[model samples]
Target chain A: MTDPREAGFVGRRSDGSLIRRPLSPHLQVYDMAQMTSALSIMHRITGVIWSAGTLLLVWWLMAAATGEAAFAAVQWFLGSFLGLLLLFGLTAAGWYHTLAGIRHLMWDAGRGFDLPSVYATGRAVLIGTAVLTVLTWVLLLLFWN
Target chain B: MADGKTVHEAALRTPLGRVRGLGSAKSGTHHWWMQRVTSLALLPLTLWFVISLIGLAGASYAETLAFIGAPVNAVLLLALIAATFHHMAAGLQVVVEDYVRGELRRKGLILLIQGGSALMALASAFAVLRIALAS
Candidate 1:
């Protein structure tokens, strides 16, 4: 307890014992009126999902380049129930991550740091992802043979 | 300040000197900046790719080949692949660094991720070239 970390706020209790303290806006301590924390975590989760999604894309592209037979195998799997399920999840994660990324970029530019805008943008990302994922699937189904 | 790094009036070194190496990594922000840069590129590239993919849903092999053979599609596909692998590596590095407590494990995982991303990007780019040039 001789040293203090920058982010770890420590305090002395009434009993004179040292305890790791949390400053303001800590999730459990703070009011739940703002959903920003949940959205922030989801941004990371979807980003991870999108990262894995790149491998699937790579697989598809590799197969397409290989030959007709190779490509057919990939298409067959992709059209299957299991493959389609993964694709559906990827689509939703992709849309969520995409919207979250835009929100992050705005944050980088210092545009949406205000409390109201933060909540608004979080909800917008949720709704946008839902709408966009549905539209993408609809478009794909319309062309499905 | 790092943990257990106590500063006292009797200490010879200033606060800046005491915490010099414990502070920010010199190129930490560069990693952050690159993440942002690649993400910005991905924004439009992904949108285009998704739309093109949907449009190609029912396309025949020959049609798909012809589409990818187009200069614009080939180039964009390459960009998309490059950006994707680049972004993924950067993003994963952050996650691993944040969560993995073992110093050795973190470094090993990061090296693996970077190497794998480079290989995957090269593989995908090579595929695009083969398709674009062969046809």
Candidate 2:
């Protein structure tokens, strides 16, 4: 009961006592260049972003179903500067998550465990996401215009 | 003398596991499986959706509506809607479980994620249906 090791919380004692302990080194202290940590954290973050972005999808669909004017309003907004920015953000998130999911699938199959390839693939995911996003927008501008 | 020696049995559960009572919620495997399946399904569906959206971008309202009304587009859009939401819910649930502290907040957030995604999926499906069936 006296030892802090048995306590779950940082500043707590085993016998239901509390003590303030300094916070441990966190994100600021971590080396983000290490692909493993950075990519894992990015996966969760983009997943969260995409989760919130799902509402936009719903809004678009509902607007379309509601009426022409409703659909146009949504479209006009999406076609605006801020809207494109938002869409671009979502696109980046989607591409990042998709690439990361593929990387995870490889890991799940035990394919990319080697350190060199892990770092290589990590770099590839970042590069690939950027390439995909830009390529998509280029195609969109070309055809959709 | 050998029979008189006492034997100690090894504990099956770890100390933390026993304290937690339930080793796992047991739904994690299902969540993992579905996330993978939906992710795989989404790979192609998302491509199709993006391409279709780009194609319809500058078209008139009717053109866009007609695109969704097309049989193949309607079916794929419906699938995309369902899979995307399911995937989002599963992924977000993991994120919430990892970071959202407190029993009430965690459970409440998880419930909100599940319920909100399901509702959106259903609404999106109905919207696609209205577009597909109206014409």
Candidate 3:
């Protein structure tokens, strides 16, 4: 065995070659060649967000069921700046998930498998999510106030 | 048991049967089917939810309760709760399976997600029911 001093921390083979350390491939190694892969991963990530986001919905429903005072407390929190930020994040996540989910359904029907169609649909999902989110906020601002 | 195969396996298998039976997990197809079905249902349900919530924004508690208490709204809300939570549980289960390494921890998390989703779903539905029927 080679002296540990020559190798320092890294292990060395008998012939002076550095031993290969096992490492998991990480983000730095991955070359995402197309948008579909990124969008596909985002779909799952946003799904997780959407599921957690439903907690707000549950909290709102529970509050409403309780009474006015309880509901008002919830309303106050939801009307706060941080709460609005959460709402906006949820809004974006919801729309993105919806659009990406539709793309998944289209794939289930055996369409959009070709590379061109995949990229096109990926772009559509991104555009559609933005459009829907913007439209929702515009309507909210225009009418809700 | 000739050739260690069931008679029905050779006689009744179709192309669809082959595909369904060919996967390593042999179980993902059902999960996929359920996800798709719930997602399709959620498409309209979620839209209804967003629009209704928009209408209810800044509304008084009484007005919001009244809106939910309407019979149609209550029914649709119930449907949305069922579909959405079921969908959420299924989706989260897949994520847990993919990332969680330790066997016990993975199973624990899967159970947690399922149990939590069920609890929340029940709570949400009860809230809707209480409003629609009681007040």
Candidate 2 per-residue lDDT, tens place, B5-119, comes to 3323345567867666554564436778889899999999999998888887788888888998899999999999989999989888877766565668878999998999999
Q: What would the TM-scores of all predictions be?
A: 0.83, 0.82, 0.81
Please compute DockQ, using alpha carbons, for every candidate against the native two-chain complex.
Answer: 0.42, 0.37, 0.27
Give lDDT per model, in order.
0.83, 0.84, 0.84
Arranged by lDDT with the best first, the candidates are 3, 2, 1
Backbone collisions counted per model: 0, 1, 0
Q: Which 10 successive residues of model 2 chain B have the least lDDT summed?
A: B1-10
lDDT of 3 by residue, B60-129 (tens): 8889999999999999999999999999999999888765656688789999999999999999999999
Q: What is the DockQ score of candidate 1, to 2 decimals?
A: 0.42
10 residues in a row with least lDDT, candidate 3 chain B: B1-10
Candidate 2 colliding pairs, count: 1
- Weakest ten-residue segment in model 3 chain A by summed lDDT: A1-10
The deviation in Å at residue B25 for candidate 2 is 1.6
Candidate 2 residues lying further than 4 Å off, grouped into runs, are A1-29, B1-23
True contacts kept of 1: 0.49
